[model samples]
Target: MSPDIVTDPSRAKRLKAATHAAHDRLDKSIMRLEPFSSIDRYALFLAVQHGFHQDVDALYDDPALDGLLPDLKHRRRLDKIAQDLADLGRTAPAAGSKPVLAGDLPTALGWLYVAEGSNLGAAFLLKEAGKLGLSEDCGARHLAGSPEGRGLHWRIFTTALDAVPLTQEEEARVIAGARAAFMRVQFLADAVFIPSPSD
Candidate 1:
């Protein structure tokens, strides 16, 4: 089943923006990966966006169905995601020159996956918080305040996730588990760093 079916369109749109922000951040993270630099940041960004669709597919067990993996294992998919990102960071030059960037498209995407994934995961966390009749403010505050070292924009994005609806304390427990699982996945994805090789 396609993963797009389950992903909220608005969420996907936000993910796209987040992906663009990552590309811009990469421009600063590594000067060599600039949009006009030898590297094609725009193409790389599109590739990373494509990776999101791939993630959605991985998330779904069937059309409109959740992933096959248990909620606790949701982060497990980060392994493949990191790999895909590493591939994205590298792009071939128009003249067929050697790959300009130290890493590939997947690596660039990896950076983005870390940011946007957290926001999405926070959404689930908020849902859980709502279940307990507790305002997601506690968790949302963490995200808003960038408690986990996330950026200001990301913190705000996480707070946005808290707006969703979820009921029942038991459901909140499940969502919390999902949030924890998401953090694990984000950590794994963030750990994949491909340094530039020495000349």
Candidate 2:
């Protein structure tokens, strides 16, 4: 099932609209860092991924979220990301402060939405990793396509996400959580992708 096939009035659509600006800004910021310019730069990019995934690692196991999304546990990529870091001989960076969603299920869903949505783009990143001589079994495991494939995986998630019941206030929190998720990635990217003194 392609995501395009799932076009319905949905929380997924709403969240996408709400976070568009933040998402675009983060994309530009990451591109500015030129993460794919070299193996070293790609390693830094992996570190940023590790940091962000670590922040939301626990949410994959949240009972409430699991009930909402099918096979929620399988959606986690933190372990894959950690392995990718190790494959590059880089230690996984410590997770930053806890996510703003904390124990809030609605907000956590929002964060998960952003995290899961990123997988769709990972296909392209995985190609870039190929230029660095990294493959799914090597230094790019975290970016590999799921067995179900990216489009189907995303469609399944958004279908689940759009169906989750929330009040108007909770919906607002979901948007806030998504924006915060983007901000967190931007922060991590900035911290890890710092230019050398010669640059």
TM-score of each: 0.23, 0.91
Backbone clashes in model 2, listed as residue pairs? none
Tens-place lDDT per residue, model 1, 62-109, is: 321121112222322333333433444533222211211212222222
TM-score of 2: 0.91
Predicted candidate 2 versus true structure: per-residue lDDT over 1-199, tens digit per residue: 4333323348888889999999999999998888889988998999899889988988988887888899999989999999998998999887667744447987898789889999999998889889989999999999998898999999999888887767777878888888989998998897778755777
Q: For model 1, what is the C-alpha lDDT against the true structure?
A: 0.34
- Candidate that scores best on TM-score: 2
Q: How many clashing pairs in candidate 1? A: 16
